[model samples]
Target: MPRHPTFTLRPLHAALCILLAGPAGAQTLPDVVVSANRQEQQSFDAPASIHAVGQDAIEAAGPRVNLSESLNRVPGITVLNRQNYAQDLQLSIRGSGARSPFGIRGARLIVDGIPATMPDGQGQASTISLPSAQRIEVLRGPLAQLYGNSAGGVVQVFTADGPERPELRMSVDAGPDGLSRYGLQAAGQSGAVNYVVDVSDFQTDGWRENSAAERQHLNAKLRWDASEQTRVTVVANVFDQPVSGDPVGLTRGQMEDDPRQAVANATLYHAGKDVAQRQLGLVLDHRLGADASVMARVYAGQRDLDNRLSIPLFVQTAPTASGGVVRLDRQYSGVGLRYSRRLPAGDGQVLFSLGLDHERMGEHRQGYINNLGVQGDLKRDEQDSVHSTGVYAQADWAINEDWSALAGLRANRVAFRVKDAFITGDNPDDSGTASFSATNPVLGITRHLSADTNLYANIGRGFETPTFTELAYRADGSGPNLGLGSASSTHAELGLKTRLTEQQRLDVALFNIASRNEIVVASSSGGRTVYANAGRTRRSGVEVTHSAQWTPEWRSLLALSTLKAQFAEAFTSSGGAVVAAGNRIPGILDRTLFAELAWQPRAWAGFTGALELVHRGSMVVNDLNEDRTDAVTLFNLRLGWQQTVGAWTLRETLRVDNLTDRAYVGSVIVNDGNKRYFEPAPGRQWGLGLTATYRF
Candidate 1:
């Protein structure tokens, strides 16, 4: 007997942008345009879980340095600021990516319709430029599976278009712990072309011992009307971080004694990382007919990385050891095309979309011994590459006046190849190749309950494959784990969107997911880790969001998420420890809540103020659930003032975080073999910012 999968998903932009615009006593929420279904559609009518963070929310009294600063407000999404910039933030959706060792996996990241995530299903958010961003959209649940491999969710960032009139803006921000940022932006329209350019530099000096970092970013965009029915856009960006110190994690006792202290080995090894990246892309859109259109995009990028780890000196002596210092020069590129058409139906119309995506990444990887802060003799070298291709088709039908249906299918294939360059006496040719493929399908339906209420449900399949890093070693230290299998999942979701009153809106969703051959760490020793397939795992969650405009000057928002993620079958972990069937997944909180109250007065010179509260439940550090972080609650406050005179505009902002000065763990390292798992959150901190703009 085949078991049917069942689940529920939430709404689109449910709690954001409700009061960003509109008059003092507006009765209806503003309409938002989203690309959740690979087309521009009203979010209120979309049958998926999606949210958009606008420019106002992203730039509100914040440094605009990290995505974690603004993503916390979205329900069912978690952005853990490690504070150690060398490792990047840890992001997860509904517990899907909780097991990541570092960086991002189990999700797809897109910037300007170009994939930020590599074909191997790994990504870093450090390259994003927030200063010139217009909006960020997050999509979750079954519909997200249409994006292909590791599509536990999808996050996309879009750059703002140029202004109608020429303008120049400069901003400066300063804070405690030697934190500072300087930014410049220029935007204007000239003839048939519109352009926007931004540059920024940020630095921080030791928020914790041995944790200093500096970075610079440059972003540019240009758009033009190529023909009467065609438009073209070009985007380019660069990111450079010469160095960022890695403090690593601390033990429970070490955190209790002093939360700001770095691990002893981290200082001894001088752990750190250096990164540089540049990318360019082009997009073209053309109208084929009154009810038909076509879009195409091409992008390419290169990244250079040098990372130093805290592995002991003796660990490098082993024949199979890959050394403590790592270097990588990587090149990635992709191309995409989509065509959409509308056909007449009995009562409404059927919208059809067809698309194709192809991407590839190649890397020159090397390893060297870390002799203190310097690199020693080479220990390993290899050339690795991955290629991914996907084809999909979708249809949306307005079955009747009160009902709608959506269906989509996608086929994907990923191939990985490695060639060994360091074939020493003891290390034979460790090169290997592997390939994985999957076909995913999704179906959704929407029922109109009333003029102000909608009910939706969807179901789909998802797939994930092991990355080059995960397959780098075998549990027995033989060679690459080419036998490791991929993971597949079934997802289902149900949701409700309703307006409780003229000024209040509510969104609720429930979802369930089950996976087979789930990936897990089989063992970890020295600087190497091996992975294996677990029997089964399950994740179930509920999300709710409420937004209300009490008056013209008062607004409130609330977002809540609760998830239960666990192993569905018993499994053995590192050191032969049996993980019980019901053990909670490591590094994922069971519950989280965010609430905010904002105020603005027309008579106070454009003054605005807001108070925010955040709460998180305790999370286990390892698969055994033997150790956990403490639950915590935090408060934040922000105030802003703006004044305009003639052609000049000036704005000032003040922000305070962790207002109660509570000490807590911000994040945890899952399944760390050495028992160093805790990353402590900072105490009370404040920042001030000033901006000036001129119109010509």
Candidate 2:
């Protein structure tokens, strides 16, 4: 269920510092700090739009849940849980990748210091392990493009590190529709080394038919202080999902007839998937001198996946068609080196950072016919590879106490190659190569208006290349659209950060972006999703956010966004109808609102209560804008209690979601040729979770 938005959410800063000193006669709030720029900086002074959500707020709603559970309220971002586990979640920022059918594309994703997003700008957050998360940082706007080969949004999930004292934690959670989760974590520091490890298992029976899922995950991190000036950190993670079912989208008629029923073909093909991933990363940090430093990070990972779709049987007979069953064996790796130096400049200080980043992904893909729950005749086979390399530099000059400037530039190159191994007489070699390159620059200025306020503005360009999947098909009777080029764009944002009162903080921003060669949906049918370049488009939006600590017992947070995304140039149709200029971009809601309130009265020791409200404006379902999802409002309530006994703490939480039990579509499959666009949201769900922690 969703409702029209009541506009909320906004924040931004520039490099160097945007310090809002604490008020007189009041305990000052600690500076909001971030490390996205390879150095510690104050949020009020950074030139980019960034937001950080801490563990308390993260778990206050639901621990170990999808990002959709916690991120809805954050400005500049949207993550929708389709409830179809096999497809994972759909996430976007500023409507950049809102039309993606599955996973995340067009932006970037990171966990700790490892690249969760590949070099090709494609990513998935299924491996985030919310139970182990200490915080999540989102970086948006033009500066995000400095990360290279992306459309300018960065989502970084950081796992909790070891504490000075040994701690052991265990948790159990259960909810309606047979949902269950069990987790364990251990962390401690000893001498020069610190370590943290977490393991969890999750399972959910479908709210709708053919949508059950089970997953097992493990994550661990170790940090060693090699010397006074050197340190080494290692991060490792493993994920396995033996059963993640796909319910597929439902036609409007089917949704009305029986929203809980699976499409006939989905059940007939045993639509589901199995996934396994393993990753390892190491970071070495060393201080060269008081004015210079170096940091290097290297990572490697692998993924194995098998999936079956609801393709029509007749389509499988086409000679060039890839069958309904898909299998992938992928290996990916990367390394990053960055150097930083600070120099004195007149009355101001200058900070400079230089870096190089490189990554590559190799994939072996195959397709076969689905024989009930088994794999059948071979149909497609190929090897796909992607490599990206970049060099970047940034300089921050604190010209004066009240004024500062930051400038950054980066040059990036990405190459894609594919080799068809299943070439036959009729399905001749469908192999080709494509390369994309771009240079992006960023500039921003911040003015300190007062001890606790600042005004900032920034402008930058963003770039993105098509993924192998998007380039795999050519709708014009050709194979692999290798000639398809990259997309480029320019954006600018003006923002303000200030303290309305000693107890309240607020941030607001207005931004606009215009782009060329924007990727758009061409069609989605017969189990093949294709993409093509739209001539041009523009997106503009406003965001506002406020956090207030009212009375010691009550805390409130509100975030809201309003956006207008439209085509700037008319484009001929891929699905037969011309897409006229000025048409609304499908899948991007016009408005969104997220609000929350928490109460922790002093009289009720160890007790807390929270209420959350999420409202989404109606979203157009396809490029043609012929249909739209109904707007609905959802309410969630949570209550929790903590108790201490003999060096141990016990905690319990209960949450009720979608209290109104409203029937609504959670997301859409944009431009589905079959016109099955809606994916129904679950109604009236409740969960109970319990945790125990021991300290030594």
Model 2 has a clash total of 19
lDDT of 1 by residue, 1-696 (tens): 111222122322443454433234644556568888988787777788888888988888389998899988888889898888888888898887777767788888888888888998888889989889998888889999999998999999999988888999999999999999999999999988999999999999867887899999999999998788999999999999997998888888888898899887788989888999999999999999999999999999999999888889888657877788989999999999999999988898999999999999999989899988689989889999999999999999988879999999999999999898889788788888999999999999999888788899999999999887788777765457888999999999999988777777778889999999998866543335678888899999999887777777778888888899999999887578899999998889888888899999767868999999888877898889989887777899999999898999999999999998888898988777777788888999999999899999
In candidate 2, position 43 carries an lDDT of 75
What C-alpha lDDT values do all the predictions have?
0.86, 0.85
Q: After superposition, how far is residue 410 of candidate 1 from its true place, in Å?
A: 0.6
Indicate the TM-score of model 2: 0.96
Worst window of 10 by summed lDDT in candidate 1: 1-10
Tens-place lDDT per residue, model 2, 214-267, is: 999999999999999999999999999999888888898998888888888889
**Which segments of model 2 are wrong by more than 4 Å?**
1-30, 476-479
| Residue 489 in candidate 2, Cα distance off native in Å | 0.9
